[model samples]
Target: MGASSPPRVTGRLRRTSLVDQAIAALQAEIDSGAWAVGEKIPTEPQLVERFGIGRNALREAIRALVHSGLLETRQGDGTYLRATSEFAGALRRRTSCSELLELVEVRRAIEVEAARLAAKRRSDRQAAELERLLAESAAAWRAGDVGRLVGADVALHTEIVRASGNAMLLELYESFGGAIAEAIRTELLDTATYSRPTHSALVAAIVAGDPQAAAAATAAALDEVRIGRERRSIGQPSR
Candidate 1:
């Protein structure tokens, strides 16, 4: 009798067996916080037994997570978690310094227009909110809390964008906030001395209901960001 061919590896079964299921199972463990950040995962034997997966499948899953920045493997030690959320991990892995600088420019474009629109359209309540946010941010700056200052600065500008009365514009700004914050935090300590007055000038323009002044303030604020980025790029001491 002719030799029987080995079992064919059908596409459907292969799809179900190795790649997708392993990735999904591992990612679920991460998303559910089964493994906390900086915590080491189970050894290969334990994972293989728990998941009923072979060493090969478990290794593939580990490799995928490491590539995604969710985990890191030490040469001698076990794999360790690097981030809490997948999106945050992926964002950290993907964003380069040059890309962050480009994002600053994008923020400048959105915020400049939003400031003008806000000056023209903000209601009294929105104006009050802007003032309060700016005050919180300035206080954070004066307290030498760069972390809190970054949060407040993002909040105040986000509020200004909302006051523009354009839903789409607000959505875009909200989506980009994470990336912008990452960029902002890089030089925030060095730039804090300038940021307080720059943000104050923006709030002043918005409150005065002068579109031209608001636009100019936005420009000035973004210029400071640009200068900060350039200093970091060239390794100059932040003034």
Candidate 2:
């Protein structure tokens, strides 16, 4: 006879963002069939006790899972399991600020050349779209809408890649869009200042057909963003 499988044990979460860690753990449990679809999850007290997390933290985790469609809440009934798994769910894991800064660096590496090529080859339509996206990004910032800012930032960079006239470069940038948006959203939290090489300057360089200036402006802008994130992480004021 085959040996019996060992009893399952949920690991204790360490000190960090308890809500985020709880969300990850609960999602894994749902994926592993610890809670089947259509079945209600444990009571709030049970979950809080089981996870050794505060009530507020566990509730926030449940709320996030509900938002992600992995779970659903009923009116005074209970939260029911929804999805067993999600494609790219692991990619949605909460990233450390430093890890997100690394993603920004990677994205900058792609966009620097993209900006250079765009300066050399942008069409009138691509230039117009880039300008529109920059305006929208600035508007979103002024309105304190981080979500809109993320979308606008992605759109502007995407337009630059499109203007590069290189299908492979555009494809590469497309693949990184979602992760880049996630990082940017995290990095911009509580950041009231926009970085150097303002959108206008970058666009002006591209409009002037100056590849070197465009690339330099792109580097400076992304480096400023990176520095801002580093400062945020260390609790230092951004320069």
Candidate 3:
């Protein structure tokens, strides 16, 4: 027997790995708008053939995306694209508080400079806007509207950064906006530490065009939030 023809080296090539193929195909479809938000995706078998993958591998890829919040599944219905996938989820998952504190430290550095610029460059209109946001914040606290208070707090800080008239500073501030907002909501607004007087001081400092005062006021407010978080931690019952 003629040495069994070197185990039949088939000319047909194997395609990419199943998981990568599935991810690539799905990503392309999403990028092309083939799978728009709220639109159900094709069944598993369909994806298997489309990406040339086995059932198990295809399911694994889909499950990964689902966990990432890029895809949502209903019990009876098919999977669909989520309207929005928060990048913050990834950040929170990948980084510990110590890692994030480094980022916050950087923010402290930039915020000081931003406050200085804001004091020098803030227009009358910007000052008025900051005042309005502060007023709303005070009103929200008095009315015990936690949600509204958080919104006003974010708006107030954002306005102050915007008033700095430095696009780069504003962009840096925006990068942390979501994290800051969540922090305020959970630590400040949820606790009784935040009060009308705290917001009033911040507003007054910004309106007075005093960079040192603005920085000092913000530091104080954040100190209160930190203290609140520490208190909650201390109050937690032993597991």
- How high is the lDDT of residue 236 in model 2? 96
Candidate 2 lDDT score relative to the true structure: 0.77
lDDT of 2 by residue, 1-239 (tens): 99999875545444237778788878777756697444689999998888787887788888887776667799989887655444222333437786778777877889899999999999988888888888898899889887788778878888988999999998667655545666667667757555523677898899889999999888888888888888889999987
Lowest summed lDDT across 10 adjacent residues in model 2 is found at 85-94
What's the TM-score of every candidate structure? 0.64, 0.61, 0.59
Candidate 3 per-residue lDDT, tens place, 1-239, comes to: 66655574443322236566776677677657686444689998888877777787678677777787567779898897653233532433333335444444555676666766787789999989988898898788888888788778878878878988999888767655555655555555345656567667766777787888878766665555444445555674211
Candidate 1's residue-wise lDDT over 71-168, tens digit each? 78999999987665566566545466576677778888999999999999999999999999988987887788877887787789899999999999
Off by over 4 Å in 3: 1-87, 92-107, 234-239
Best by lDDT: 1
Pairs that clash in candidate 1:
none
| Pairs clashing within candidate 2 | none
Q: What is the Cα-based lDDT of residue 186 in candidate 2?
A: 68
Report the error of model 1 at residue 237, Å.
Answer: 3.5
